[model samples]
Target: MAIVVVGGSTRNIGKTSVVAGIIRALPEMRWTAFKITQFGHGVCSANGEPCDCETAEHTIAVSEERDALSGTDSARYLEAGAVKSFWVRTRQGQLAEAMPRIRKELAATENAIVESNSILRFLRPDVYLSVLDPATADFKDSAKLFLDRADGVLLPEGELGRPTWKGVSLRLLEGTPVFAMMPPIYVGPEVVAFVRGRLAAVAADV
Candidate 1:
């Protein structure tokens, strides 16, 4: 199965839009998409809010999204034509507890796409794309940790000029391909073509 993982430097930077765009652009992939939400530090996984409960109880939770009109990220995936979609919720550092299920799901799927930077710790996807916006200053450490592993990058429209993110240099993405994207239409024809070509090449090699 081909895995396309899409992550971003920060939240609300069009990561979901990009994932949905890809799924829409390539309807034949019949992608089983996943949107992972990790609640870090003092957050409740079951309720996604602050609670007095211990972290163990909220180790991991996975649920299939059935309603395309639910107005959730996973629902967006379904709305975009994904054959199946799931939302994985886990404690900040407890993702390992969900891997057995994740692995089994991947094994049974034809093609999969995930939206999380931390997943790189468990599996190496066929294509890993990092979506970034220099306009956003809050960069997640997980995103930075796996930035170099990105097969390609999706950036905002217009010249990026020099990025101001601390400890992140242009050198890190010196040779990786960058595709300009705009909101609401995060994945354009050119980017779609690039992804299709890359996946096709991967299939040919197999």
Candidate 2:
């Protein structure tokens, strides 16, 4: 099975839209999409709400999305034509606890598309796309840690003179393909072609 991961330098940078666009653009892949969220302290993973619980059961929660009208990121994946969609929630630095379940789902799928920079720590996907915005100043350390592994970087359509993020270097993306993306449909024709080519190449080798 082919695995593709879509991550962003920070939150609300259109990562979900990009993943959905790719799923819609390549429905023949029959993608099983995943949206991974890591909640901070005092938040319950079971429901993603503020809580004081610190139990193992409350540390990780994984649920399959069934309603396309739920207005959640995983629901958007279903609406984008993904055959299956999962939402994985875990406390900060606790994603390892959810991987067994995630791996089981991945093993049962044809093609998988996951959204998270942290998952790179566990899986080496066939294709890894990182979305970034020059306007956004907050660059998570997780994004920085895996930036060098991105197969392609997606940026805003306009010229990115200089990223506003501090202490972050673009040199990590040396030799990596960069694609310009806009809202509504973040995956452009070129991006789709690149992904298709990459997946095809992987399948050919297999």
Candidate 3:
């Protein structure tokens, strides 16, 4: 099975939309989609109290159509015609604790698409696409850590404008294989074809 991971420099950067778009475009792949979320400290659950939880003991949640019909990212996957869907939640920087379960889920599918940058540490995906918004100044350390490893990048639409955050310049990403991605939408056909062709090559290499 081939695994494709879609990640971005920060949140709200169209990573989910890209995954859904790919699933819609490649329905024959029978993709099993996963949307991973890592919660920060002091987040409260039931009883309205902050709790310290072990990362290893964290649950890897799965949602079929009933749970998938909602407005969550997993639901978007289902709406895009994914055969199966899952929403994995874990502690920040604790993706390793969830890798075994995640791999188990991927192993059961014909092909899997995961949406996270941290997962790159455990498994080398068939294709790794990093979505970048040159206009957004905030760049997460996770994205920076994995930037050079991306097979290709999806850049935001319009002219390549300047983006600065805390004295750092995003111009460092210039000259990468960047596909222009307009706001609030999935990537265009050129980017999708590039990804599919690259993924096919990777599969052949294996």
- Name the best candidate (by TM-score): 2
lDDT of 3 by residue, 131-180 (tens): 87767777778788787778878877734566655544455555667777
Q: What are the runs in model 2 whose C-alpha is more than 4 Å off?
A: 42-57
Per-residue lDDT of model 2, residues 1-206, tens digit only: 99999988887778999999999999999999999888776764334478544445577888899999999889999999999999898878989999999999998999999999999999999999999998989888999999999999999893466889898887897788989887776999999999999999998999
What is every candidate's alpha-carbon RMSD to the true fold?
2.8, 2.8, 4.1
Q: Which stretches of candidate 1 lie over 4 Å from their true place?
A: 41-56
lDDT of 1 at 130: 95
- Would you give me the overall lDDT of model 3? 0.76
Winner by TM-score between candidate 2 and candidate 1? 2
Query: Residue 123 in candidate 3 has what lDDT?
Result: 84
lDDT value, candidate 2, whole model: 0.89
Q: Is candidate 1 or candidate 3 better by TM-score?
A: 1
